[model samples]
Target: MIEVKNVSMSFRISQDRIQSIKEYLVALIKGKLKYKDFWALRDVSFSVHPGEVLGIIGHNGAGKSTVLKVISGILKPTSGSVSVHGNIVPMLELGSGFDFDLTGRENIFLNGAILGYSRKFLNEKYDDIVAFSELGEFIEMPIRNYSSGMLMRLAFSIATVVNPEILIVDEILAVGDESFQRKSRQRMMELMSGGTTVLFVSHSLEQIREMCDRVLWLDHGQVKMIGEAQEVCDAYQI
Candidate 1:
């Protein structure tokens, strides 16, 4: 289960900058400084029960990603609190945990380690990961040389293999070709069948309707609606 209470996040940006070190010193002496504040999320609250697939939809800069970031513990909420129960596997940005300089084989181990998998566990699952990625011989080469699709494939394979109690997917299936998209969808369904709670964020209403049990609409950093997938989508369209 996941519970979010009155969550809010804000970012501060410097509005005025010093031209040089001397100017910075003078500004400090004069006590003249400027900044601007932007709130990405405000009083956002929601919950996900076990074995639920919750889809989130919103326009650009509507705090969809910000909400996911807070859930994943990447960014701390400036106000309120988010509490998650169980192991969480966040597939937010593809290849975000990988080391570009390392080989695909090496990165597999590195990523697994970051997810708390031991070297022995990774070694046992190595073949499954390699087969899912379909990089074949390229798996031995450095990940920097792999195409974006290849990197995404590898990342997805590793993330889904462990069957985490909670899965957070953010716009990952939007990449790759039609066939890969189908495979990704199938993998997600398999995870759902295992009773994993899934928090899915995507722009494709069709995909959300087909895959999610419920949908939540977020607009301007607030929950606009939540209900059955089609019902919320219909309300959102209105």
Candidate 2:
């Protein structure tokens, strides 16, 4: 289960670009540092039950990604509270944890460890990850030489290896080739059917209507509406 109650997140952004650390230091010491408080989320409240699929939809800057990051423990809210019970696997910004200088074989362990898997676990699952990525002999090469698709495929392969208790995905389904996209979708469906609670953020209304049980619409940084997928989607369309 996932519960987010009156969660609010804020950041203090510099009003002026200082251009250099020396300039920044000068401004800081001179009490000339201009700043503004940007609230990414404001009094946002929602909950997801075990095995439920909830879709978050909004325009750019509507705080969709910020809220996800908060729930994933990537950011702490300025106020309010978030409670989650389960093993969470976040698929936001695929390959965000990879080292381009590292070979694909080396990065599997590196990225796997970032995802909370131990050395022993990664060692055991190494072959399966390589096979799923279909990188074959290329896995030995530095990932810096890999195409964008190759990089994302390797990251996706390593991330979805475990049956997570809670899955957090952010518009990552369109990975790799068409065949691979279909395969990834099937894998997601398998996880959903296996009773994994999911928090999915996507711009595709069709995907939300088809795959989600409920939808939450965010306007600016607040909850504009939340209801059945079709209902919220239709309301959003209008």
Candidate 3:
């Protein structure tokens, strides 16, 4: 289960754009770095029980992603508390862990290790990951040469090879070509039904309504509504 209570997050961002490192350094030394408090999330609270699929919906910068980051332990709320039970696999910002200098083959181990997969586990699943990625001969090439779709495909394959008790996804189903997208959706459904708690954020209301058991709607960094998927989605559309 995931429990979040009275969560508020604040970031102090520079009011003026510093175009260069030298300018930033000068401003810092002169104590002239103008900053403003930006509240990304305000008193957001919710919970997802095991085997539940909870979808988060909001406009950009409405704190959908921020809430997920807090739950994944990627960011700390400036106030309040978050508790997550069981292992978590976060697919937010897919391919963010890659080394462009390395071959796809090499990064299977490199990126897998970053996700806390044991080397022995990667070794056993390496072939399966390669096949699922459909990279074929390109797996031997440096990742820098890969197209964006190819890169995301590899990342998705590596990340989804093992199912975790909790899955956090942010528009990840849009990763690849149409055929791969269908396959990815099927895989996601399997994971969801396998007793994994899923926290998903997507712009596709149709997809959300279809896959999610419940929806949380945020407007301006606060919970606007939380209810059945169809109910909240209907209100969000109107």
Q: Which scores greater on TM-score, model 1 or model 3?
A: 3
**Is 1 or 3 the stronger prediction by lDDT?**
3
Q: Against the true structure, what is every candidate's RMSD?
A: 2.3, 1.8, 2.2
Candidate 1 C-alpha lDDT tens digits along 31-122? 77666788888898888889999999988888999999899899999999999999888888767679999999999999988876778878
lDDT of each: 0.87, 0.92, 0.92
lDDT of 3 at 143: 98
Give the lowest summed-lDDT range of ten residues in model 2.
184-193
| Model 1 collision count | 0
Clashing pairs in 2: none
Query: What lDDT tens digits, residue by residue, belong to model 2 across residues 10-121?
Result: 9888888779999999999999999999999999999998999999999999999999999999999999999999989998978877998999999998999899888988
Structure candidate 3, residue pairs in collision: none
Supply every candidate's count of residue pairs whose N, Cα or C atoms clash at under 3 angstroms.
Answer: 0, 0, 0
| Rank ordering of all candidates by lDDT, starting from the highest | 3, 2, 1
